[model samples]
Target: MSLKRRLELLEKKANYLDSGVKIPQDFKKFNELIGLPISKIPPFKELPIFGYEMDIISNIETHRDYALNKARGIGATEIILRWILFRAVQNKIPGRKFLIVTGIRLGLARDHIKRMINLCYNIPGIIKQSSQYNITINNSEVIAIPANPAAIRGYENVEVIFADEAAHWDLLDDDPVLEAIEPHRTKSNAHVIVVSTPNGRRGFFAKIFHNSESKYYKDVKPWIISEGLLIDRVEVEKVQKEDYYRFEQEYNCQFLTVRYAAFPPEVLAILQSNSMEYQLSD
Candidate 1:
C-alpha cells in the first residue's frame, strides 16, 4: 500500500480505537501499542521498561522542562528518543515540530536523526517523509540540528526540544546555543528536555542542574551494580582502577572540580556567592 493510504487506514483504525474520545495521553499505553526497537540486547527485539525508565518517563510527562544527569550506558538517551516519537505520533496539530540539538559534532546530530528514521521505518505508517536531518509524521515533524546558535534559530511551533549530550556543547562566557533556544521555546510554550552525563562543574547543563530556582525538573541516575543490567560491576571496577575521577563523573554523576583549575570548586562557589551578596547589598 502507498504511504498515504497506509496512514489513512491507520488514522481510521486510531479513530475506531478511540471511538471519538481524545487520544490517550499515557506514554506507557502508546509504548505498548507501538513497541520500541532494541538492537543492543540480543534475542530481545523490544526495549524493556525497567522501574528507572518508568520513573524518568513519569517525570517527563509531568514536567514541561526536565534535566537529566544520567550515567553512561543507562539508556537515558533511548528513553528520550522514544518520548519524542511518542509526542510526534500523538500530536494533533499540523506544523507542530520537535527539535533535537546534539553535541559539538555535526555527525552526532545526523546519527540521532538517523535513529529516528530507523525507528519510524520499523513501525509502518508512522513516517510520512524523512531526510538526512528531519522526519515528518502526518503534520508533525522531528528535526535534528547541530549544537550552535545559528543552527538552532528560525524554527517555529516546536512542541518539544531535546538537548542531547548537552554538557559537551562548546560554550563560552555565555551559552549562546541555549540563549538561542529560549526565544523559540518561550514563543511556543515548548517543553525543553536536557540529557547528558557530567562533563565538568561548568557549562549550561551543570548550571541548570545545580540551580534550585531553575524551572527544570532535575534528576540524576548513578550506576548501581545491584541492578546488574546496563553497566556491570567488572567494567566499573576496571574504569575505577584506570581513573577514579572519570568513573565518579561518568558512572556516578558527581560534578567534580576541574582537574587543573586555579581554585577549588568550593572556593570558587564561595567567591561567586559573596560577589552576588555584595551586589545585592550595594
Candidate 2:
C-alpha cells in the first residue's frame, strides 16, 4: 500500500526475474533444488513435502534394498506414491515393472491407487491407467497383490517390489516371495522395499530388521527423520499404558510381542508357511 513497500516488491520481482536458476533435468536434483510445493503454483496448489518425507524419497533413490519400519500416520506410502509420479514424468523410469505387495490384498491396496490417481490428476505430463490388478504409466507399470488371507504368488519380471506391512503378511518363511524378490536384486539392481510395523519377531520383516546391518538391506527408522514434529511426545506417553509393547513396535520400531497379546508370535509362525501353497500370479 505504501510507496516504499511497492518499490521493494518491484525490486524483489525484478531480482527474481534476473536470477539464473536453470531447471534441473534429474529428478533428484529437481526435487532437492528448486521444486516448490504445488501450493506455490497457482490453480493446482496442494501441500508441501515435509523434511522427513523428503528423506524417505532420498532413501528410495539411493538404496537398492531399503527397509522402513515406522509408526502409523507417518506417511511411508505417500512419499513413495509422489516419487512414482515424479518418475512417471521423467520420460522413463529406471525399471519397467513395479509391484506393490499389500500384505493383505489388492482390495486393501485399492485406496492407495485411488489416492495416487487423485494426486496426479492436476499434474501435467503424467497419466495413470489402471487395469484389474495393474496401473500403467508412460514407461512404468505398477501391480498390487496380497500376501495374506489369500496368497498371490509367482511374481515375475518385477523390477521393484514395495512390500507394505510385511509383518502382517502370512508367509513367515517367505518361500516364493523371497525367491521372486531376491533374484531380481542381483539381476536388475532391483530395489526391494519392506515396510511395516512389528507384528512380532518371527517373519521375513523380522529378518530384514535384524539383518539391518547386512549389505543386503538398508534400514530406515522414523526417529532418524528430523522435522518429525508429527510425533507428539504426550500422545506417545498417553498410549504407553494401553499397550506398551505394541506401542514400542509401532512407534519405536522395535520387534517385540505385546503383553497379553491375542495372537502370540509362535502361533503366528505356526500358521505361516514357507511355501506358496496357492500360487495366483497375475
Candidate 3:
C-alpha cells in the first residue's frame, strides 16, 4: 500500500459515512481502493501482470471497441471482467445492459464475474444479486450468453459486449448476428472487446486481428504473453517439434495457420473445375 492509496481510502471513509451511499467517481482507483488485488479474490492464486498489461487496461477504459488475442491459460477473462466492472459501476444510466458471449456454457465467465461481485461488498450502497450466469451490479445488468447468432442477434441497448474464446464461436460467419451486434454499437458507440486464443485462420476472430486498421476495430496486443508456454522447457521443446503450429498459436500467442481446410486440395480442385455452376437451356 502506498501513501496515495491510504489517502484515497481515508477520503472514501468520509464520503461513505455522509450519505451511506457512494458511487465511485474515478474508476481508475476502484481496484486500489478495494484493497484487494485480483489474485487474492478467489480461485485465482496469483497474477503476474506486466507493465504493458496495465497500459492496455487503461487504453480499454476509453476505447469504443477493442480485441485481445492471448495465448492459452493467459488469463484474458480476468482482464476483461475488470474492465466491464469499471464500465458498469461508473456509468450512471440504468438499463445499462451488457453481454458476455462465450464459446460454450457460461461456467468460466461466471467464475471471473463472481470475483467482481465480491469486490462490490466493499462499496457502500451498491446493490448486487446473482442467479446463474446473470448478475446485477449497481445499475448495470450483465447476462452471459453462448456465442451464436440466435443469442446475439436480438439484443438491443447493450452498453458493452465481450466475446470470450471468440475463435471458437459457432456462428462466426453468420451475417445476421453481425448485423444486430453492429447496430447498437453504432447507436451508442458501445464498447466491445473480443478475447480469444488463436484457433483457425479464418472467421470473425481472425478478421478482427488481421484487419485492425478497419474503421471500427481496435486491436489490443497481449501484454502478459510470453514467447511460448514453457511449462517444462525440455518437454515443451519435444512437443513443439512434433506439433509446431499448435505450439505457436495456442501457447505462443501467434495467430498463424494452425487450422486446416475442411476440404482437401483434391476436393477443392474438383469444386473449382465444376464451379458449382448451373445452366438452363430452353
Per-candidate TM-scores read 0.81, 0.68, 0.72
RMSD to the hidden true structure, all candidates: 6.2, 9.7, 5.6
Model 3, 109-192: lDDT tens digits are 676567767766666556567776777877788888766667776676688888778777656373454555666678767777
Evaluate all candidate structures by whole-model CA lDDT and list the values in order. Answer: 0.78, 0.62, 0.65
Which regions of candidate 2 are displaced past 4 Å?
A: 1-47, 91-95, 148-157, 223-228, 261-282
Best by lDDT: 1
Worst lDDT window (10 residues) for model 2? 32-41
- The residue-level lDDT of candidate 2 at 13 comes to 40
Candidate 1 RMSD to the correct structure: 6.2
Candidates sorted by TM-score, descending order? Answer: 1, 3, 2
- Cα TM-score of candidate 1: 0.81
Estimate, for each residue in 171-271, the C-alpha lDDT of model 1 and write its tens digit.
Answer: 56437878887777579988888888898878888999888898788988888822476667888889999998899999999888777789987898899
Judge candidate 3 against the unseen true structure and give its global Cα lDDT, from 0 to 1: 0.65
